[model samples]
Target: MLYQDHTSVVCKKQIFHTEFILRCHYYITTFDLYYTDQIQQTT
Candidate 1:
């Protein structure tokens, strides 16, 4: 029972980590595009 609980916890952590990474990548890409647009407008 303890082992099963541990496995589940580890799996949850992995899922959370992947989701967090994806969210960060999404925000970073969106920010980059916005920044580029701003630069283009200034030029």
Candidate 2:
């Protein structure tokens, strides 16, 4: 039972980390798009 609980905790941690990474990637992409648009408008 203890082992199962530990496994579950590890799984949850991994999921959280994955989600955080994805969010960061999305924000970075969004920022890049915004910058590109700005440059295009200026040009």
TM-score of each: 0.97, 0.90
Prediction-by-prediction clash tally: 0, 0
Q: What is the lDDT of candidate 2?
A: 1.00
Worst 10 residues of 1 by lDDT: 1-10
Against the true structure, candidate 2 reaches a TM-score of 0.90
- For 1-43, candidate 2 gives per-residue lDDT tens digits of 9999999999999999999999999999999999999999999
Off by over 4 Å in 1: none
lDDT of 1 by residue, 1-43 (tens): 9999999999999999999999999999999999999999999
Alpha carbon lDDT at 4, candidate 2: 100
